[model samples]
Target: MSKTIRMLNKDDYPQYEAMETGIEFDYIAHIFDRLATGDNHLYGLFLDGRLVSVGGYSIYAGSYAMLGRLRSDLRFKGNGFSTEVVSYILNEVFKLNGIRWVGANTQEHNTSAQRVLEKVGLNPYITLHGALTKDTAALESGAEPWQPVTSLQRKKDWLNQAYIRTGDIFPYECYYPFPASAELFQDEAIKQWSFYENDDKTRFVITKYDQKKYHYLHAVYPWHDLTSQPGLWETIASDYRKLLQQTDDETYIWMDLTKEEAQTLPASHQFELPSPWILYGKEN
Candidate 1:
C-alpha cells in the first residue's frame, strides 16, 4: 500500500466531484471551480494512485486564510484519511510566508470533522446562529437613522462595548468571525461598516456583499444583550426590508447572531434562524 499527498490542479476536478461530501450547500458543491480560478489552494491525498481525501484553504483580507471543503471518498472513511489531509494542508500552508491567521467553519453536528480540526490545532473560538430573511411585509415602521461608519479609531468606548458583547470576536462576514480590533476595522476591503444609534452612538451594523452569491446580503450587528434593547429588533427588521426593496426579489439578508438572540427574534419578523455554526481558528 502506498499514499501520496500534493497540491491539486484543475485536472483533478473529476475525481474531486466524484467524492461524496454529503453537503448540499452551493459553495461546497462548486469548490473545484473556485480552486481552478486561483481563488483557493486545494490539496489531495491519494492511496495507491486513487484519490481518497481532499482539503483546501482561501486567503482573506491579505492577512488571514480559512480552510474549507474537506472531504473523503465514502468508501475510505474510518481510517483517519481526513485528518491526514488537513494536517498535510496546514503544514504546506504555513510554510509560505506572511499568513498571520488561519480559520475554519463547520456545522455543530459534524463531530468527526470537528475532532479532525481540533487535532490540527484549529480550536473552536466562536459560534453563531445564522438568521436569513426575505419578507418585506415584516418591516417595522420606524427606527433611528444608520450613520455610515468609515472608521473606529475615535470610538474607543463603542469598540469596548462590542468586545464585551461578542467576546472580542466580530462577525465580519456571514459566518466568519474575525478578531474585533480597530486595526482590523481599518482594512479597505470592509468599508461597509455602519451604525444605528441614539445619543451615545454605541450600536453598530456591518454589512458586506457575499463573495459567492451576488444576490445575498451578509450583515452583522453586535448589540449587547437583546433583553435590554428589545426595540432594536425593529430597526434591524426595517433595515433588512428596506435593503430587500432595493434589490431583486430573490435577494435575502443574512445576520449572524447569538443562539439566544436568534431564538428570541420577534415572531412577526420573517427571519429563519438555522442551527449555530462553529468557527475554529489558530493565530501564528
Candidate 2:
C-alpha cells in the first residue's frame, strides 16, 4: 500500500492525537498536551488523507529514550503496515546520538508484534513476565486478582511511614523510558515504594498482570532484597507469605528464569505467561 510518511506539523497534531486517544479508549489529555508542547518528536503515516499509523521518540537527554505510542488503526493490522512504520521511525531515530536504547512491550500473546520487530532487525532481549499491570486484566496469563484498593484502605495496609512522593529509578537504574512517566497513571491503582527498615517489615508486591490467569509470583519483599544482601529463595518465601497477608488488593511481580539473575526465583514460583519479551537496543 503506497502512503506518504512524514513528521507532523503543529496543525496535524490534533488529528493525530484524536486517532490515538480513540484507539486507547482513554483520555490523558493533560499528558498529551505536554507532549505536544515539549521536546519530543512525532511521526505519522498517512494512507491518503487519514493518519493510519503513528510512532515517536521520547528523548530524556543523556539517560535514555522511550519508544512509545506505536499504534496503527485496528482496520489496518494484517496489511504489513507496521513493518514500514517501524523502519521509518528507526531511520529518524538514527539521526540523534544520545538515545541509549529504545524499549517496548505488548501482551505476550501478541506474536504478530514480535514478528514485526524481528522483521525490522530489532532482536528480543528479555521477556519480563509480570512486569506489567493493567486496570482490566490484559494479561493472557496470570492469576492476579482484580480488586482495586481504596485510598483509605491503602493507608491501613501500607507501611505506617510516608513513602517518598517521587518515582525512584528501578533497581538497575532504569527510568520510566518516557516522559509520560511524569503523567500520573490510572485510577487509585498506583505503585508506591519505600524502604521498610524494621525486621518486622513483611509484605510482597509479587503478583502479575493477567485479566484471566494466575501469573503472579506469590511472594513479597519490602526491606529484604533492598536492605540486605540477596536473600535465598527459601528464606524470602517465608517472609513473602507474611507480606501477602498485609494487603487485600491484587498484585504480581515478574517471573520466568531466562536470565541468570532471574533464575534465582523459586521453581515453585509460577506464572500464567512465561514466554519472555527481551528488552534490547542500540544507542543512536
Candidate 3:
C-alpha cells in the first residue's frame, strides 16, 4: 500500500469531478475560479495513485483561514482518509505567513467529521442556527427600516459586543467564525462587510450579496439578545422585507445562538430551521 498527498491544480478537475464522493459539490466551478485567482488552495490524497480524499482551504482578512469542501470517495470510508487529508491541509495552511487562526464548520449531526476535526486538534467553538425564508410577505413589516452603517468604529464595536456574548468567536459569515479583532475590519478586499442597523440602533446585521456564491442576502447578526429584546424579531423581519423587496432571491440568515435563543424567531415567518451547525477550530 502507498499514499500520496499534494496540491491539486486545474488539470486535476476532471479526476476530482469523477470521484464518487456521495456528496453534491455545487461549488466546484466557484472553487476552481478562486484557485485560479490565488484565493483557494485544494489538495487531494491518493492511495496507490488513486484519488481517495480531497479538501481545500481559503485565507482571508490576512489573519484567518477557513477549511471546507472536504470530500472522500464513498469506497474509502472508515479508512482514516479524511483525517489524513485534513491534517495535511492544516499543516499547509500554517506554512503560509500571517495566518493567526484556522477553522472549519460542519453540521452538528456529522459526528464522524467532528471526530476527524478533533483528532486534528480542532474543537467546537460555536454553533449557529441556519434559517431561510422565501415567503417575504409572511415576515412582519412597518418596523423601522434598516440603514447602511458607514462608521467602521461602530461596526467594530458591534462585533466586539457580539464576540463577548458568544465567548470570543465572531460568527461573521455563513459558516466561518472569525477571531474578535480590529484588523478584520480593516481589510475590505478579502470581504466587503456591509453593515446595517435599525432605526433605534438596537438591532444590527452584517450582510453581503454574492449572487454567484453565497445567497442573495447573507446576514450575520451582531448580537444575540433576541429573546430579551422586545420587537427584535419584528425589526429583523422588517430588514428582510426591505431587502427582499429589491430582489426575488430566497434569503438565508445565520445567527450564533443557543436553541432557546433561536425560538425568538417570529412564529408567523416562513423561515425553516435546519439542524444547527458547529464551527471547529484551533489557533495556528
Candidate 4:
C-alpha cells in the first residue's frame, strides 16, 4: 500500500513519542510543547494506517520557518520515508503561510539525515562546534586565570569586536543569527571573561554558572592570532575552572566554538569530535 501524509493531532503524540530516534528523548517533549501552543505545524506519514514518520516546521519572524523534530521509525528505514516526510513538510510550510525560506540542521556525521535534507532541497551552509569539560582539572593544570569584565565599557567594546568578527567570517545571509546588541549580553545569570594579550584585548569567553548541574562557557571569540598564542586553550580551560569553582553545585563547563576558529587552535585544544553541524536552507 502507498503511504499517506496528513496533519498530526494530539492523539498522535503517543505514537510519535514511541518512534525510536536516538535523540527522541531530548526532543519529544519539546515537539509536543510547540504543538500544544499551536505555533507550529506537525505532520505524519502513515503506512498501512500506522504513523511511521513525523516532522514539523515552526514559523519564525522574517518569513523564515525552521524544520523541527524530523524522525521516522527504524523499522521503516531505507524506504525513502524521511525524504518524503521532509518534502511534505516543506511543501505544506510554503502553501499554508507566507514563509520565504525553510531551514534545518543535522549532525555533520549523520549522512542519512543529510541526504534526506538534500533531497528535500535544503543545502548545507555552516558548521558549529561544541564541547564540555567536567572537573576542570585539564584547565587548571597550566593556564592563566581568566579576567572578569566588570566594566560596562569593556563589555560593550567586546560585543562590538565580536560583531565585526562575525560579519568578517560569515558574510552570507543564512548563517546563524546573533544577538544584535551588548544589552542582550546583560543576562543576570551569566558571568563574562576577557583574556588579554600584551595589554591589548585578544579574546573573550562567557560563562553561566548553573547551580544544579554545570557551568556553561557559552562562547570563546578570539580577535588576535590563535595559533601563535601558546597556551590559549589552557588559559580558557583554567578560566572555566575558576568559574566552575564559583558554584559548588556544578562541576562542568560547556564550550561552543566555530569550525574556522577551532582549526586555528593547537592540537591540545583541538578535540576533533564530530564536525559541528550543517545548516540547511531552501527558498520558497
Give the candidate number with the greatest lDDT: 3
TM-score of each: 0.83, 0.49, 0.82, 0.63
Per-residue lDDT for 205-230 in model 2, tens only? 32222221333332223232322232
Task: Give one digit per residue, the lDDT tens place, for model 4 in 102-162.
Answer: 7786888888888889888888756666544554333233545455667766665665677
lDDT (tens digit, per residue) of candidate 1 on 127-194 = 88777777524444355445555555534446566763444777666667776544455435444554
| Cα error of candidate 3 at position 115, Å | 1.0
| Regions of model 2 farther than 4 Å from truth | 17-24, 27-30, 61-63, 129-277
Select the stronger candidate by TM-score from 1 and 2. Answer: 1
Query: What TM-score does candidate 1 get on C-alpha atoms?
Result: 0.83
- The whole-model C-alpha lDDT of candidate 2 against the native structure comes to 0.46
Model 4 scores worst on lDDT over the 10 consecutive residues at 170-179
lDDT of each: 0.70, 0.46, 0.71, 0.61
Candidate 3 global CA lDDT score: 0.71
Tell me the lDDT of model 2 at 198.
Answer: 27
Local error of candidate 4 at residue 107 (angstroms) = 2.1
- Superposed on all Cα atoms, the candidates' RMSDs to the truth, in angstroms, are 3.3, 11.2, 3.4, 5.9
Instruction: Count clashes in each candidate, considering only residues at least 3 apart in sequence or on different chains.
Output: 0, 22, 0, 0
